[model samples]
Target: MLFPVALLGVVLAAVAHEGHVHDATPDTVPETEFQSWVAKYGKQEDLPFSGPLSFSHLPYAKCLEEPDAKFSVAVLGMPFDTTTSYRPGARFGPFGIRAGSRRQRPGRGYVLHYGFNPYVSGKTILDCGDVPISPVHNGLALDQMEVAYADLLRRPIANEEIDRTRSLALDGVEHPRIVTLGGDHTIVLPILRALHGIYGPVTVIHFDAHLDTWPAPPGIPAPYEAAEITHGTFFTSAYKEGLLTNSSIHAGIRCKFTGMEDLEHDVEMGFALITTDDIDDVGVEGIIKKIRDRVGSGPVYLSLDIDVLDPAFAPATGTPEAGGYTTREVKRILRGLIGLNFVGFDIVEVAPAYDTNAETTATVAADIVHEFISMLLFEPKEKTAESDFRVQAGRNGDEL
Candidate 1:
């Protein structure tokens, strides 16, 4: 069992370079009124984000507020997508997620059933933007994936980046929860390796339609390897490298269209899959409970492929399988993970180009991050819900 929670003791000076969108002070409200407002709202967003402002940590931009060291969660965006078989635009995922989140109305930004804003709770999170990637031709993109892998694998270990991620879990700073938004599932390999080194044997709760654990097809030519290294075979690499724990669960797999031989091969790999049929049988809440128990006590790492949602719910992803978890079902499952020793979480494969209305997946994706941030940041209070509701309703009064 991992320590209830731990943060690498290094002070997060890196994120100090990143900038924050909101600078509204707690003192904006008078003390008496502020206390009354807190009593009324518990902890909820005054408005759902619907604006046109956001911040990022990409090489193009500067830094943001780094808070007073201790934090609970950190978000990193790996925007290299040389591995997707079909759509190749996911390399821009980090920008889209951050842009979506920045547009969110800060402060209880995701105030659904529970008050949420993963970041605003004074949690130290760095939008450590895209990992520096090489500019390769799209046709040869998949072939050059090895370059990104090499960069990710050897990022000057024991360096400042490690110190930043390590300190996120420390007391008085942030909760040290990591939520990575991706270039492809392969991006998880390096991240998991780093995390496993920090906390051994972490659970990888993956939600995707395809069993991503296929062996890297040999030789970099077309035909068999035609799909570029692809989003198709990330897990295969991790599982083979012994980087991922065998106990990790692969949920939301609805892939029966492929040849039975491939299916049998995946089955032999010891992945306990929760197919669409299983999700239907157990109910999302029930399945969530099952996940909580299986990955119990230990530090858990979660990776959600937006395609986990049915194509109807998220048409903007690189790979859109027909039937999958409904939007509501996905929320139920994510919401249930509260209070667990979740080390970090990631949401990948969101390609806005595939969207008819950009809001389809981007909005949902943003809301998911917003909600997760809210859950991890807020200390559970007895009156949290009631207070959040009243305060939200009284925003005009509360803000005044």
Candidate 2:
């Protein structure tokens, strides 16, 4: 009786196996609904640590790859620091800045002072990724940057609401504004070359601890053509190339100069100096007024070297000075220049290897970029006059 029971169990197991194999055939299974699966999993918000890394979690677009891709403003990275005078790791500045910006999501990007969210202000802003730069050759890398920037500058505007009347282009055609994350200060020379092709010579607002307009030092021998266009002397090259307007201004300058002759050369190259000590005497408001008065309503290209901040505030830079603006002072000055006609901007010299674990330098650089987006999207004052607290208080018969 035990043998007969074992045979019966084996026969039942064989039958079940045959049935399972038949049911598991490819044609017998239902196709998966990808749309349903995507609907369930794809719409979630990106946590700061989880998403594909981009500046402030903004959309990533290969603007260079897609010719039809349009944006009002773009965050472009130039990751070549071969021309750096001191630190070398600024080649990674773009990556450090994007990593530092992880906490700034588009949903929470509202500025209380400006009373609007730049991320959601109906303008298409994109992280266009980094320019492909050749590390082995400086000349090749610079030329590549120039070509890439010119292509991006010529792309069609995504926001149709932008006022073409305010454009500084001689043709009055609207062009996209670019906020570049720099390789080093040398990148600005190529950038100015690109901008000159469109708007002609633009007034530059340079924020740096150094004059940057230094000619090759007196002792540096002749026939050193390659040494002439370093990070320190890019502005000198720009002036020679006729890429700058004579009204350019330099703020936060306190770098040790060769002599009064350096100041005379800087002035000759088209820059009015505003020292770091000016903040103590004339105040932040005074600095802003001076910059505004100098640049006026002309097309302005703003360049900020990370060394403009004191080493205590932003130590992850190539060349740092003791007395420089704090992050707060820089932000206030940027806010005060909201209505200026800015065509381009850059934050340079962020060498993250020199930074602390807190990433203070990259973080502050990213926040300043947030201010750039706000300034670019800011509506004309006349349109927002109704929302002014002063006007609202008057209407309600309120007193301070």
Candidate 3:
């Protein structure tokens, strides 16, 4: 295949500069990296964006194919939405979210109000690119996703001085965390499985419009059967596999159930529900406290279903519901979660096919991810004593 000269030049520029040292005198012979870059590539507009598809256009964002290197966190894309019960194009969520995040590149300052920059917080962040999925087979797709996440978890965490006093590090070595751009809520099942393999059963902090803990559809001979792998039933599968703790809680729920028994069943599976209506009664602070109280000091996994926001604010999701929280409300709530023992996170159900000119849903998805990264860097408003939480780091110093 013949390549365009501009594209070829950009590719060659990237390939040629991997380990070359630049001379510093700009006027003399293009010594420094920027000068050498300009001399070699001609101009900024001449080269294509470097690095794998990444959020925030971070320079450190690297492809997973590179020899293993230390990174505090990695953003992995799970572009598999075959199991969605409603709309299907969430398969493009990672792409849409990445495009939306590019809008932040010029500023690269996501948390303006707090003045926190995750990229410069002594933590290396990588965009590990998207996991390949078997489009025709949902079961195989999920299996592939689980294996991908597992492989990522095995890599070394970037070397950083962890604040044992406020960091999520329960052991001496902090395992790199993953911030997953989800294909759909079903993606959580595989992610949870990989996380469970590393951290044991984690307490869940689920934010969604639906309970997602519905009993697996009938006629599946046994629990967690492949036929039962729809988005709505994965939590049940997670529960069956002992991947979650009774301390788990679901916020922003508004989906109607067949009967009260469904809620009872969810409780039995060890999850508490904080309906969207409860947000008004308890207030955001109260809701935050409830979440913290429920999750306590256990290792926690956060799953954010964009549909948890009212369709008015985020209509691009697959299963949007009315009467859900506003974008601002959700942001504040997530910001409140900063000091918890978060192990991993996902923002799912962003089907940009349904979005308006505003790119409302994709932008919101990016912002949610931004907050997750913020949580990784910001000190909790109040740091608890190191002895308060129970954290056992795995043998490799990269697993929890």
- Please give the lDDT score at residue 247 for candidate 3: 98
Q: Rank the candidates by lDDT, best first.
A: 2, 3, 1
Model 1 per-residue lDDT tens digits across residues 277-377: 68767887668767766664555678888889998888888878898888888886776666555666778898877766556787778767766665455
User: What local lDDT does model 3 show for residue 84?
Assistant: 87
Better of 2 and 3 by TM-score: 2
For candidate 3, write residues 106-216 as lDDT tens digits. 235535544457777777777778888898888899889998888787676675543332234334345778899989889999998988777778999999999888887
Q: Top TM-score: which candidate number?
A: 2
Q: Encode model 2's per-residue lDDT on 312-379: one tens digit a residue.
A: 99999988899899999999888777766789899999999999999998899999899888877877
Candidate 1 wrong stretches, greater than 4 Å: 1-72, 110-112, 115-117, 137-175, 218-229, 257-261, 267-270, 382-400
Q: Which residue segments of model 3 deviate by more than 4 Å?
A: 1-53, 60-62, 110-112, 161-172, 221-224, 380-400
Cα displacement (angstroms), candidate 3, residue 240, comes to 0.8
Q: What is the lDDT of residue 87 in candidate 3?
A: 84
For each candidate, the alpha-carbon lDDT, in order, equals 0.60, 0.87, 0.79
